[model samples]
Target: MKKILLPALLLIVLALAACGNKQEEPAKEDTPSKEQGTSDTITYQSEEGPVEVPANPQRVVVLSSFAGTVHEFGVNLVGAESWSKDNPSFDSFLKDVEEVSDENIEKIIELEPDLIIGLNTIKNIDKLKEIAPTVTYTYGKVDYLTQQIEIGKLLNKEKEATEWVDAFKARAQQAGEDIKAKIGKDSTVSVIEEFDKQIYVFGDNWGRGTEILYQEMKLAMPEKVKEMTKKDGYYALSAEVLPEFAGDYIILSKSDTGDNSFLETETYKNIPAVKNDQVYQVNTAEFSFNDAYTLDNQLDFFIKSFLGTK
Candidate 1:
């Protein structure tokens, strides 16, 4: 009887050990990462510094005046940092957002945000992280379209972002076709700006020009402009070089106070674009700044400009 009891007890112990092992094993394949608390995890890289994000952030605080991405993602914004040049349209989108400070770490901490997003150039990232997960984006990382996609990825709305871009592209293409029909194919245009008494011609690669010149009209690149862009990619070039690399049309951009004073100058008068009265002025807000809503409006105006309806 003792031998039989001993063997039975051994079998029961082995069974118990097996059950314990099974319980200890983690169900890797069966469980989803979302349920594993990965949604709050924040991950971002930028020229500014390393940012660690909390998992599945609920309330987010944004510390930048440019909240174009918020509208794109339709995320609830808890706060935004005020910039000197905040766009008025941003007010409608950010009606719910509170104004955070550039230096006020305590204010950000009080919000209890799950994450924080801002430009890497901002100096408050480390301080902000003590309060919540922080992510930074470099300005040079993407063109405006790609930037929207990146923002979507961070917000976990990548599909929506992709669709938005596709819609914009289709609209821009249709607008482009309508525009080219008016200006005629093979017409070349220059993006000109006179700021602070200095003339600047943005290359085809310029953010605004890239959309209008590359995407909209499919205009040809100027040889000299291409040469300058070969190095730093794109920049504001001198307006004085207009005659040396004259274009068929000069789309001039002006400040609030700019007038025909350039027309009074001999150099501006001598330029082929000016001589033909081909100079066209665009608003600074629409073209100079590239945001989701602003770009949409600018694209329409560019279509009009090309159609000769402006």
Candidate 2:
């Protein structure tokens, strides 16, 4: 009876030791079960409504003016609109990017873009949405800087976009101060573009560096331009009235293809800015948009053009 009791006690001790060892062992991590799902998309609150977009967009197509802004965010652009493609400043980066338009549904389909951006005016919106998450913006719905921030939110790069915007504003302000010191505090500036056989002057928000010239830099706009373009943001006039809109300094944006004969006429040639060689000519395609890339370029151009410093 004693031997049987000892054997029973020993067996109990061994069992208790085994339990302690098991308890001390590290737990195996839980593996995902078949019922679990990993979502690779996020909901973006676009102007139209809430839409699901890839959390990390691999291929993107831009069908409007935001190409440069998107490109500045380090996004991979597979296709872009003709205007963006035609921009000489974008040539190096967009060399491999295909030129696409709102009308090119079949072509865009072939690109298999995970994202599509365009203006609200684009046709085939529904079809584009079927192909991928499509986001559109109504022009002038927001200020130029806010527009960039909006795109940053859409792309999940708001932090980066905000950083850029802040830094840019500071730099532009400094540049403006430097320019004012050199050109005088009250010297006025104007932005004019020649297109479709007509001459147009722009307000502060209009592209072609108007934002930098008037808004960011706080430079004075010619009273005539301010009066006419105050409501429309831009005004079209015959070449005869060009002098009325002329300022101490002029930024002339002209397309090589447009009828630029007006620039040769005495009416335009006699403008104070032109006669004083204060006119800085830029390509319409290059200076047309207020995107990050274009804005940086525009700012640099202004610094160099005004101060003769790179």
Candidate 3:
């Protein structure tokens, strides 16, 4: 009896030992190793500091700007600010995306985004940080082209961003030369916008094709206008002062609310640009973005408007 009991006990102990070995092996083939788990995330240098972000983020949210850029990069978006929701190009892609209210923190938190991109001026930034990793950009701190590149770097797509910038620069240079050939090289251009209460003249980087006109297109600005706006980025003037800022060619940006009656007035009509039929009116909704999307659209507009060839 003792011999039989000893053999049975030995068999049980051997079976238990085999099970313990299997558990200790940690199922390496089926389970992710520590190194593999660590690889799922990466640290990015942001305006605030180094931040850990997903190595391959599947959900991203853009709050105030750069929605166009993110879309251009083929990244998946989980939400967007109300402004992008109205963009015709973004409307379809954002149909399912939640519209984040810039004024409301709860709206953003509900989206469960892995990342959030916005302008530095956005309100409630502290609350936004609580929801996800947030990165913010200050407009005018860099040129539009550089800003886009910075955003691309933040998203880990610097290569694509740089490639696009190179291509766009080449295209813009060609367009500038073509425009200068069509219109006299000496001809000057101005970018102006009429808001509800004020008129503004912009320099090279404040959107409304100013970058393309003054920087990329190499279009000249009137000496007086340059002296006033070159440092401030923009000059605000009354309707009566339109002629002072007007150039040989004017790109006028208007929003839905601004009154266009000023254009009919003799003051505006008498400007050389208006008299020469060189005032190209563009919608603020379409022309205000300082992103690649707006740049591409405005380039075509510049060609058609200036060269009369699409």
**Candidates sorted by TM-score, best first:** 2, 3, 1
Name the TM-score of candidate 1: 0.69
What lDDT does model 3 reach?
0.67
Q: Give stretches of model 1 more than 4 Å off.
A: 1-66, 78-85, 89-91, 94-114, 215-217, 233-239, 257-263, 269-272, 275-277, 308-310
**Each candidate: how many clashes?**
6, 0, 0
Poorest 10 consecutive residues of model 1 by lDDT? 9-18
**Clash-forming residue pairs, model 2:** none
Candidate lDDT scores, in order, read 0.54, 0.75, 0.67
Go through the candidates in order and give the C-alpha RMSD of each one to the true structure. Answer: 19.9, 23.9, 21.5
Number of the top candidate by TM-score? 2
| Residue 176 lDDT, candidate 2, scale 0-100 | 96
Lowest lDDT 10-residue stretch of candidate 2? 9-18
Q: Residue 77 of model 2: what lDDT?
A: 95
TM-score of decoy 3: 0.83
- Where does candidate 1 clash, by residue pair? 39-56, 40-54, 40-55, 40-56, 41-55, 41-56
* C-alpha lDDT of candidate 2 relative to the true structure: 0.75
TM-score for model 2? Answer: 0.86
Tens digit of per-residue lDDT, candidate 3, span 27-70: 32422111112476656665566666665677898876677788
